[model samples]
Target: MAATEGPTVAQSSPSSTPLPPGMVLGPDGKPCRTCTDWKSWSKLAKTKKAQTQQGGSGSESAGASSSSSAGSAAAAAVVTAGAGTDDTAVNATAPDDCPPDREVLGRATWTFLHTMAAYYPEKPNEREQTMMKSLLSSFSQFYPCGHCAEHLRDEMKKEPPKVASRMELAWWMCGMHNKVNTMLGKDEFDCNKLDERWRDGPSDGRCD
Candidate 1:
């Protein structure tokens, strides 16, 4: 549903803290943590804190030291939140009940989409088909990540949703998911496993 273009650095005014390069901003032009990976967000926060402290203090070196200490402490907390030092890591399991990051949001949205596809009627009536198309259009318009929503809209124009049948919808979703995965440099999932993964469970009966 979403794709990534590589990140570029943000420019800031002299008086303001410089955000980390590659930090994505929301529609309001403020830093968007949910739109960014955990590593980038953490770096941006630490940089901003350090810059603020430096501006406030008499001794520049002392301010730097204090900033480093504070940054380290905050990072430690994140580590405890189950995010290791990986650049793509997200605090999905954070103890403080933090909001979902981009990756977490993607996973949840994909789950919903796949499950919906799995249960779709084999022969949807015209009204049901119309409703499904409307739902997808609305979803594309209102998805939380603006860029992601835009990407989905563009992709939809290129290849509209195939919602005529259950299997048709399921394969379409798998193809879309693979497109996203390819953009993110991830391995493509096997579309053949769709029912096994989403509806039928494994042949091994482990999920049963």
Candidate 2:
């Protein structure tokens, strides 16, 4: 009797390499055109496609949620990230803790008065004269004679007044008095009395 033949391996063509296990040669003797390992490849392709679709859908949903209400979107994002709401609450209440508006205004007024006193100088021009008068007048409103007497006295000792016009001298004196009053936080004294005592006196005696 003839010996029984085991299953024969298909011969590969000269131009083709042999297929791996679980693969077979096609009629052309190339690896099989039909996917022999198709199950895992198909599964992986499906998973990747699903992931791409899921990512696109997630982005669209996020955009829609944000458009629905900006504040709600922000709150949702914050909560989803595990942050607390205390910071927002604190920011909302911060303005209430500020100082009164009037006190701020008073401080700003005093600052302007002090700056003008330090920088303003007598100029022969009409504009300069007008500005000096205006500055002095504004100062007087905030710092009357008695309020500023001590500061005025100190200033006079530092810089004696020269022979300027009576009006010019008065303006200088008023500015000095305002400076003193603002520093001391008191009402200014009488301008007429100051003038009477110091009109013929040395420039430094205006404060005294």
Candidate 3:
């Protein structure tokens, strides 16, 4: 969800606040905890805690220092929630019945998208195709990560969803997902494996 390159919007400029590396600022110029992974959020929380305990008047960042107490509390809650367990366990473990981090949310979202594409009617009518396009348009507008949503919208404009048939839709989804993977420097999934990954069991029938 976090923009690996930079802020997503033109309106968002660098804040006076000294945010942790890779922390994303939302449109409001506030730190978007949901945008970045938990590690960055933990760094912010620790910095605030150190300042608070020392009672020092540290240099305040634009949005971070203003809401330090509330933001730090929220970050601390996420960390302490998994207390009595291994300290290393807390990182990237927000999906176990807690609010999901960006990675968890992204994976769950892609799963739903690909599954839906796999199950789309093989020979959908005009109405069905229109409905599918509409659904995707709306999804791009309101995804949890604002920057991610913006990027998807841009991609959609470049190559609109192809919902004419099940195969087309599935391949389109795969291409979109691969674009994201490339952006994040991850390996591209083999499109030939779409059915095995989303719809049918593998040739060996392990899933079955």
CA lDDT of each candidate? 0.73, 0.39, 0.72
Off by over 4 Å in 1: 6-15, 59-96
Q: Cα miss at 54, model 3 (Å)? A: 2.0
- Which structure among the candidates has the greatest lDDT? 1
- Candidate 3: which stretches are off by over 4 Å? 1-17, 56-90
lDDT of 1 by residue, 1-208 (tens): 4865423335442334555445677777777766776665666555555445544552547647766656654544444332334545543233346677677788889999999999999999999899999999999999887778888888889999999999999999999889999988899999999999999999999998
Q: 1 or 3: which has the higher TM-score?
A: 1
**RMSD versus native structure for model 1:** 5.8
> How many pairs of residues in model 3 come into backbone collision?
2
Q: What lDDT is obtained when candidate 3 is compared to the true structure?
A: 0.72
lDDT of 1: 0.73
Deviation in angstroms for 116 in model 1? Answer: 1.0
> In candidate 2, what are the lDDT values of residues 1-208, reduced to their tens digit?
0011112223222431222223334334443322223322222223334444444555656666444444433333333222122223212111434432222333444445434443445344666666565654454344322223233344656764422344555555555545555554767655555434433444676555
Ranked candidates, highest lDDT first:
1, 3, 2
